[model samples]
Target: MNINLKYFKEGLKDGVPIALGYLAVSFSLGIAASNAGLTALQGYLASFLCKASAGEAAGFTAIKEQVPYLEIIIVTFVANCRYLLMSFALSQRLNPKMNIIHRFLLGFYLTDEFFALSISQDGYVNPYKCYGAAIIGSPCWCIGTSLGIIAGNILPAKIVAALSVALYGMFLSVIIPKAKEDRYVFLSIIGAFFMSFILSFTGISSGIRVIIVTVLIASTFAVIKPRSTEDE
Candidate 1:
């Protein structure tokens, strides 16, 4: 609660670009939510509570299909499980003395963008910085989803389809730079892509396929190219 204004302001500034990207991506997600028969307010609440696009998309699909609640839960969990790893890494970077409340709050806000920014900090993360980013980015995503639901109803199908690509573009923007810097990252991406494509032909659900591909590729690389202790 006693966040430093200076760090908070810096986090707000750093969050602007992330907020913009989320706006576009979540708009497309709203369209998906609409397709799933979700009301604008429901879509808004979903985005507000759950920041993972892949997980949200899978959940929406499950809703549309009228899948059993257990299946829906499993799909969402598998799709969002990567965040558990991100959370673990971020926990290690936190000050050891930070309180449980702040830790839980940061864990709740631990999206890919926020985790990347926080983990890349020089030392232990200032909770206020993450708070500042969440303030600006999270609401924009929720609002964008609501607007997207409204737009999907009024806009032409072609326009909605075009807008949906924004989410894919946002993901590429995140990964491409890292891939260029690390060949292993690039290879992992390529491997995941091919595996995902092959799995698409199978009867497995999209969410389950994602977990299978991610675990296999990540485990393979961890063994094949274990990081040095210095890197760790």
Candidate 2:
């Protein structure tokens, strides 16, 4: 088999399971988007542009609450800060011959799952393989979200309302397991709960409050939490 074909086939094989999982998670994102007053087309477009399930879900919620664009910007940056580190790590794995534009475009598919898989490779990563993973994974995410939006529109209003709240539960399911592995994460989770509770009583708009709480808590932990030499 051709070298490029071999690389793509391997990436596609690895990507298939991730794509299937993304379909399920993004489905909820679609429903949440519809509940937030976005049309199916808008929801699909938003996911395409944002390409992030957590940030988009949070942003959609903020948009529903009628926040200013500035708040949305802050929240988005806060939500996506982890990707900053992941991108740097992935860049180190790419060969020197890879074009800058290809590296930039490959970052589009660097979901938590994709990054995990890519970084686990034993040697220099193949750019074409990454592209193949993106090709398979990105579509599953986009199409799943579109289907969710369609389903959200079709369901009864009461049912849709019930389903919308599940997004929070979904977030917790992801966060709680990880939080259990680290003390700082657990403390941050608790801190966020209290901070959010206090913010609830304030006159600040919901979006601004979320943005402020996230930044404050995250920064505080960043400073207090011990950094690993590996990251240095």
**All candidates: TM-score:** 0.74, 0.66
For residue 81, model 2's alpha carbon misses the true position, in angstroms, by: 0.7
Which runs in model 1 stand beyond 4 Å of their true positions? 1-3, 153-221, 224-232
Give lDDT tens digits, candidate 1, residues 108-172: 89887777666655567888887888899899889989988898656566765665564455467
lDDT of 2 by residue, 45-104 (tens): 887777887788888888888899899998788677667766877877778798878787
Candidate 2, poorest ten consecutive residues by summed lDDT: 162-171
Clashes of 1: 0
